[model samples]
Target: MSETTEEATLGLIADIPPGFIHAFVASLSVIVVSELGDKTFFIAAIMAMKHSRLTVFAGAISALGLMTVLSALFGYVATYIPKIYTTYIAALLFFIFGLKMICDGCTMSEDEGEEEFNEVQDTLKRTDEDADVESQTADPAEVQKRSKILNVVRRITFALFSRVFIQSFTMTFLAEWGDRSQLATVILAAAEDVVGVCLGGVLGHALCTGLAVLGGRIVAQKISVRTVTIIGGFVFLIFAMTTLIFE
Candidate 1:
C-alpha cells in the first residue's frame, strides 16, 4: 500500500480491532451488493441520458460521498443511541419514497414528463442568464460588452456543467436520503473501522453510479423514461421490504 493508504489503515486499525483491510473489504462487498438495482443507480442513468456524463457523474459521486460521510458519522454516534430507531426511520423513508416514485412513474405520460423536464432545464438556463445579467455594471456600453462576453462563457459553463451538476446533486441527494445502502453503511460502520467503512462505501457507490451513467447513455435511446421510472420504483419497494426484513 502507499503511504496514504498505510496511514488510513493504521488510523482505522487504531480504533477497530479487525484492521483496515477487513473493514474495507467487508464494507465494499456489502455496499456493492446492496446498491445493485437500487433507485439511485437508475437515477444516475436517467440523468446521464439527459445531461453531460461527467457532470452527472461528478454530482452523483459527490452526493454519495456526502451520504457516506453522514452515514459514518451517524454510525459512530449510533453507539450512544438505540439503533432500532434509525432502522425504523430508514424503513419508513424507503417506503414513502418508493410509493412516490411509483406514483410519478404511473401518472406521468412520456410526453408530459419530457415537457416538464425541459421546462425545468429552460427555467434553470434563464435563471443563470438573469443572474449573469444582474451582475453587469451600470454603464450601458460596458454592460452590453460584458453581457456578450459573459453569455458565451455562461452558455458553455452552464449547459455543460452547472445545470447537470445541480440536477444530479439534487436528485441523487434526495434519492439517497434514508436509502438502504446508507443504512448498510451505518450498520457496517458500527461493526467495523469508521474510516475504512466510509472509504469502501464511497468506492462502492462510485462504481455503481459510474456504471449507471455509462449504461444510461446507451439504454436511454432504447427505453422510455416512464418505464425506467416504474422499474426503479419497484426496485425501491423491494429495497424497503428487504431492509425491513434484514436490517
Candidate 2:
C-alpha cells in the first residue's frame, strides 16, 4: 500500500514542469482561440438580447468560473492516477461533446430563436410608439421619471433576477460540460502549473463570454447556429483524433 501511494505521488511530481508563466500563456491562448466560434458564444449573445446583460454576464461568468475550477481539480487528480485512465477519460469526453454538438446542430431551428428575438424587438417598438402618442397630454418630465422608476424596479427584482440567472447559468453550465476548451484546460493543468491554468482559463472564458454578451446580438444574426456547431464539432473531433494519435 505504501509503495503504491509513493508511486502515485512520484507520478504527480514527474509531470509538473517549472514554468508557471508558460502554463498561463498556453492555457489562455488555447481557450480563447478554442472558444471563438463556440456554441457558448452564440448562447451568451442571444440570451443577452432577451434578458438583462448584467445578469446574463453574471450567470455565465459564474458558470464558467465553477467549471474551470472543476476542470482544474479533475486535472490535479489525473496527475495522481494512471496515465491510461486519464487518456481514456479525456478521449471519451472529447467524443461525447463532439457527437452531442453535431446532433444538436442537426436538430436545432435557428429560425425559431431569430423569430422570437424579432417579436421581442417589435413589441418594444410598438409599446414605445404608443407611449409617445399617449404622452402628448402628459407632462414630459413625469413620464421620464416614471420610465426611470420602472427601469430601476425591473433591474432590482429578485424574482426576475433569479429566473434569468438560473436560465443563463444552466445553459452555460451544460454547454461547456465537456467542451473543447474545458477538456483542454483539464489536460493542461495535469501537465502544467495548476494555479496558472486555473487563472488563465477563468480569464479566457470571461473574455469570450463578455464579448458575446456585449456584442453578440449583432454577430449572432450574421452567423448561423448550424455553422458554429458544426465547426465546433469538427474541431473537437479533430482534437480527439490527434490526442489518440499522439498517445
Q: Pick the candidate with the highest TM-score.
A: 2
lDDT of 1: 0.70
Residue 119 miss distance in model 1 (angstroms):
20
- Looking at candidate 2, what is the lDDT of residue 1? 62
lDDT of 1 by residue, 1-247 (tens): 8999999998986876544665576567656655544567667776777678888999999999999999888878865656566556645655675677678779967654345445544655686688788776467888789889899988887876687797788878887898767876776565446798888888988887887789844443344556655665665566556555544
lDDT (C-alpha, whole model) for all candidates: 0.70, 0.73
lDDT of 2 by residue, 144-193 (tens): 99889887776676546586787678778887999878878898667556
Please tell me which predicted candidate would have the highest lDDT against the true structure. 2
Residue 72's lDDT within candidate 2 is 92
Candidate 1 residue 33 Cα shift, in angstroms, is 1.3
